[model samples]
Target: MAESKPKFLILGGLGFIGRNLVKHLIDQNAASKIRVADKAIPETAFLSDHFMQYIQHPSVERIQCNLSNPMQCTRAFKDDHFDYVVNLAAETKYGQDDTVYKQHIFDLAVNVGRNVEEHKPLKFIHVSTAQIYDADKKPAKETSKVKPWTKLALYHKQAEDELKKMSIPLIIIRPAIVYGPADTSGLTPRFICAAVYKHLGEKMKFLWSADLKMHTVHVRDVCGAILHLCLRGNPGEVYNLADKTDTDQGKINDFLGILFRIETGFVGSAMSTMAKLNMKSTVEGVNDKHCQPWSEMCKAASITNTPLSPFLPQELLYNTPLSVDGTKIEGTGFVYQHPMMTPVLVKEVVDGYILQGMFPQPKDYPRPTPIPPPSFETK
Candidate 1:
């Protein structure tokens, strides 16, 4: 008899990466059944109809539960045996209190890990952040020093440590600034900021040096890596899921400049130092500048409510670099379909929101180059 396709469980499946992963599995026809367990439902997730069809596919199942609670975590898994369980659930917000981070991040991950250990899936993939690495000039390897820059990263590191001790076949993936369609954090905020500048018809300026690393990986590549690592990667190993972009602030701004048709620049060291001294005020000022214009654009477009926002937290505004080495995953024979950060790719993200009516598509801006349909044909 022929073997059955793998049974998959995606925790936090309503999230950006999780939803994309579900799409990947369905597109590839890789899973016999996919169970999506998350705190939110499809209606509230702000998922595009393009993705809604995939989530509501005949092979996919939806479950609602908070993974932070142990009872709900157990309920999330149920009695069924899943072949692959990917944990994408966590408090992704920045600038939260220690207790919020503790309960939602560390506590949630431990609860999920304990449940995973009990069920013992074939492969348990935990999505982590690359922010745990020390901010340095060089790219951080998986074995790099664990000096978390933000409170969010601090708990991620702690969760990683605890999950490491579990007897389950666990594989950890730390991605650098995951961006693409349905992204609120990551590059979307910067895109919105550039849009604000476009409306103002002014050059966009950043606080830090142009060279500050803000390494990025597309969400498609992130989803691709998760599946690749699940099948071929060794259990009990950690992998970094960065692209070959070598993306820094300058590269990102350059792409944004071309996409938004706005000039981009950075403040010099002296001004940046002053801004650093009063970071709270600086961050507030920047956010204030962007939010008003963003709201105006939404109003002009007749959009009542949108999940997208230009408001950036102070933690995200800091100069800390998220440099990471994606070559390790390449060594495993997994290729990044979207290797570089390009203007077209950035435009693609904006275009997705525009199509969803979540973002204003300015009539004054120049027409964008025609983009081909999303493809992972590189592999």
Candidate 2:
């Protein structure tokens, strides 16, 4: 007799990370069936052609429902029995008010946890963030002190606590800054744009300490880590997902400089201290010049509006180094295909924007071939 195929449920499947995970699973022939539930509709979500094609795959079931409402979540999961239930849904916008974070991050987790508990999936993987750790000069381990530096981080911590109280078999994953192809929200693409435009004409200057740690992981590795945990991770264990490299802002700038042949600099910490004291005027002045080109480029590409200023609010600038340790996940024999952010990866992201028509290519810039969709494997 042949074994039955595995069924998986992905909440918030239309999101950046969710969509990428779906693609990986399909490419690997890891699951026999996948059901994706999200509030987004493919027709109106402004998804790229690459993602649009996957959402329409025959083996995939797309469920259009909001996961925040308990009744909605119940309806979504009531009839389905899944081997793995991965929750990637959350309000991840960084600077929102406490109320918004509580409703979207905290409440959403509780609603999903309740449904998963009742349905009793084999494994429940909840996506969390590395921001829950306190800002320290050294790398943060799984057992490090968790003093949330932002309201966003605080709410994630609260959500993790809520998940623990539920009777579900849970594995929580804390991912550092996730960046790769099709990523718009992470800092990598933003920095690429900043370098491109700042070299073109704009004088958008910002200040940060050169040593500020900015740990990151590729989206592919993040998906791989989640899959490994779903199969072999110990219940109630937390793992920090990051790359092998200990990256800082200055190093990122240097990479961009080498790629685009542009020089990007930051004011020293002493000057940054004074600027923080008068952040309002400083931010506004920088935004005034920065927004002009960004707004123009966004309009050209038909992409949604992006805030003109690249400078984050002083409060959001939690400069405490975020050197996260990924030894636990690596100890499980999972290796990162893209261990460190490299020039090729950076080029792929920049070219992705161009392929999507989100940015204009330079006259002499050689466009790389578009990445083809992964072939579906038959077991």
Candidate 3:
């Protein structure tokens, strides 16, 4: 028997992940209803044609309102009567302090929780990050201690636990260094810049202990997991979605050095920088500048002060050791299509971001050709 399609409400539908997933749902589940709502209307035409196509089915709707307001939530429920709510709404960066986070990051999580509890959403998939995992503890798993440092991590755990406690059907997916099309977040752009420098035979710089490990996943795979969970994930559970490759700063950094033919090492480590600065903050600062216009990138580089947070063996950002225990979600018959990194997939998403003029499109490098399979390492 064919299963009936569940109606969906993507609370932050116009954002990066939301827009991507909407594209997927449109391409595949032609009959399923999807409602996209975001407080900010998209400034770019990223979703116009796709949105128009999806809305013609008489099932899709778009709402622009403050979801944090209970009345708005109530009205949405009454108007749409959706069965699934996939929340991609979040303030996901690492460095932005508490200001932007509390107002939007934590706010959206809590609002979704309230709506799920009130509406008893058949399934609520919360997008989270693996950045919160204790990097000190290698092979971070679903059972690993969650000592979240950033405001974003704290809110993720709070949102996850609260939903579980309330007995709302929920799933938490912790992704590592999420990349792919439309990522203005800076990870992939740095990769591109390095490639450009290497391709041009310029010596690109590398920062951080190359031995330091990091895990990653493509954005589409995240959407795949959400769809899989919507169909089969158990309520009151958590899943860590990760790429099969156990990436480290060394492997990728060295690869970037080779590919871009540039120098790859901490400014101070093998080639020490001046006093009062660490490799990480310095390196991150240098790379983030690639996303900006030439004048802007240089101007910002001239004035930004060194961050005070010590590189004190923190599980904060450097550690990428992760194990994606999708056992529960897998038990529900979900297998990631791209279990490991595909440079091509990563390139595609980054290019999408560039086309949309999202931040982090470093002009240092032209986009590399799409990477083929065997990108993920099993180590």
RMSD, one per candidate, in order: 3.0, 2.7, 7.4
* Candidate 1 Cα misplacement greater than 4 A, ranges: 1-3, 366-379
- Which structure is stronger by lDDT: 1 or 2? 1
- Candidate 3, residue 27: the lDDT equals 55
Report lDDT (Cα) of residue 331, candidate 1: 88
What TM-scores do the predictions have?
0.95, 0.92, 0.76
Clashing pairs for predicted structure model 2, backbone only: none
Across 260-331, the per-residue lDDT of candidate 3 in tens digits comes to 346866544544333124646645565454434333433443523211111122223432344344444566
Best by TM-score: 1
Summing lDDT over every window of 10 consecutive residues in candidate 2, give the lowest-scoring window.
Answer: 305-314
lDDT of 2 at 377: 36
Candidate 1 residue lDDT tens string, 1-379 = 1138888999999999999999899878788899999999999999987788788887889999999999999998896899899999888888789999998889999999998888888899999899999888799999998899899999999999999988989999999999997888888988998888898889999988788888999999999999998889889889998888889999999998877778999978998999999999999988889999899999999999898888899988888888999889888899999999888788888888887889888656555444344333221
Backbone clash tally (model 1): 0
Off by over 4 Å in 3: 1-3, 45-59, 192-201, 254-328, 353-379
Higher-TM-score candidate among 1 and 2? 1
Q: Rank the candidates by lDDT, best first.
A: 1, 2, 3
Residue 53 of model 2 has an lDDT of: 78
